[model samples]
Target: MSIRIWGRPTSARTQKVLLALAELGLPFELTLASGTMGAHGHVAKGNEAFGVVDTPDYRAMNPNGTVPTILDDGFVLWESNAILQYLAMKYDPDRFYGSDIGRFASAARWIMWENNELIPPMHNLVKHTIRLPEDQRDPEIAAASRAALGRAWGIVDTQLSRTRHIASDSWSYGDIPMTIRVHRWALLAGVDALSPTLARYYAEVSARPSFDAIRDPAMHLAG
Candidate 1:
């Protein structure tokens, strides 16, 4: 395989890359490097890399020791969203991503919004609510995340009400990360936590026959 991803399947970020690879029909290998390393299931489940990523060799490839690092046929890339762009641009640009400047910019915008805004609170909620042991769970953080998520998801919900997808009237690469994140969010936050529109949107997106590419039954929430 030309592409090898060093990460766990249950990782949200890694799943995004995996979905992209699946959508593109790209053959690859997964070098599990996080779970046994220290994922709270050892702390990361992304950053805790003892077994695989901590090795000097893995560090040489990914200095940060973060999961989801990709060695794509000799071109090394870290950061999941960046990897998504690389794959889309290289293999199926027009199909998943596009060369059009506006769409490109929009895709970049949504991906950044997901990483910078939505994910922080969403992951916090997940950590406190599910991933952490009952004794370790923090109700305060989970409540705060729920409140913050309302505002963040409101923006996306409004946009989705206006169109079928994030970057365009049709599905775009921009929707991939958001979809993955939203699936997790809904699982933890409950569909009622979302606006009627966003809830409906999630249902529709997940129900799509094409969603199989991104679907993982062992998804953290489902497990």
Candidate 2:
């Protein structure tokens, strides 16, 4: 199979796919598509990567012009969570993607929750704290975002009290997105400690070598 993925390694969404590939032990080509490496020698919107996203070639594949678009053989896929599910199903069906309907749906449910409930506040906190300049950063907004994220994680902590994993007794695709977000939240300054169960889960999941390989600190975007 021929697989080529385009996206900057720094993007958490892009990193999600990379971690899955590593877990699946799949070999694929990677072209920097939305970060410094993907900026086709032009800077736009104060972010060269964003410039790449607006390019005609990139837009042709993903109208959203977002990072983490995958070209698997001749098939094209976008949306990071979708990419993760597809890759898992194709490469490790009985494992990451799940072997039955119940497990598969559970994975999908958490992926959806990550996108809908968790990501917004996480993105806001990152934007106000690290992405924005000091003069532009709003403490109130950051604090509110952080508080919202804390509450979201609190729910996860409660869930962990009942099960060892997010969706099942064992690790599955459902853990990937939330693990990434939890780790991202932990990186922010002044963030509170995770609840014990949640903290233990984060420590275990984030320790996967697949995550360590693609999580480059230098890849962080300042925008």
Candidate 3:
């Protein structure tokens, strides 16, 4: 049976899963759940209209009630990064995931850094720019988040200067998380203010077929 992906296309997490599936040449089916589309087949804005994420059935599958839950045959999983690693390891281990301890650690390091240091600011920036209405958007928050993201990107730029990719000279699970977030960033205003090194890296990764298959700006904001 084909892998069934449960989540909306606009979700960053869901996009990650889709990217991984495409990269691994795996077949899958998409079920729009979350945001405008609820898991129970209801079409409405916000989580309340459908409350799929809060429903007992969804909570049973994913305690967090988050988007992008994958059912691979009988095996079920959530958490976008974990799902990406699982798909890579199961379908295309040698190429997609890092096998060596050093490589794995390097990739893991970026994932941690991204989640801890980078995502907060990035999420805030996205929320301010796209998620929030122009009248309600907080310029202070956006400026602060943008500044923080600039600092984070500087670190990434320095790292990229030393290696062709974020984790190393080659692509690994490390690039996946950053790729999704970075692409979204580029769509926002003031992208040119970002470091050239980061721009090059984004362009290079964006050129990949897997990324092309899953890239979607519509997923970032809105229900």
lDDT of 2 by residue, 89-138 (tens): 88897879558778788889988988888888877776776665567779
Please report the TM-score between candidate 3 and the true structure: 0.87
Ranking of all predicted structures according to lDDT, beginning with the best and ending with the worst: 1, 2, 3
Every model: Cα RMSD to truth: 3.0, 3.0, 3.2
Question: Best by lDDT, which number?
Answer: 1
Q: What is the lDDT of residue 199 in candidate 1?
A: 80
Q: How many clashes in each structure?
A: 6, 0, 2
Q: Which digits, one per residue and each the tens of the lDDT, describe model 1 over residues 1-223?
A: 5688898777788888888887777788888886343433535333454368778998998888888899877899999989988887888878775567688788889999999889889878877876666787899999999888888988998889888788877677888898887777766656677678788778877886556765664565622
Off by over 4 Å in 1: 35-40, 43-50, 208-210
- Each prediction's TM-score versus the true structure: 0.88, 0.88, 0.87
Record all residue pairs in model 2 with backbone atoms less than 3 Å apart, i.e. clashing: none
Instruction: Write model 3 residue lDDT over 15-119, tens digit each, in one string.
Output: 878887877778889866664444322232123333466778888898887888988878989988788778767776667645666776788788888878888
Alpha-carbon lDDT of model 2: 0.76
lDDT of each: 0.78, 0.76, 0.76
RMSD of 3: 3.2
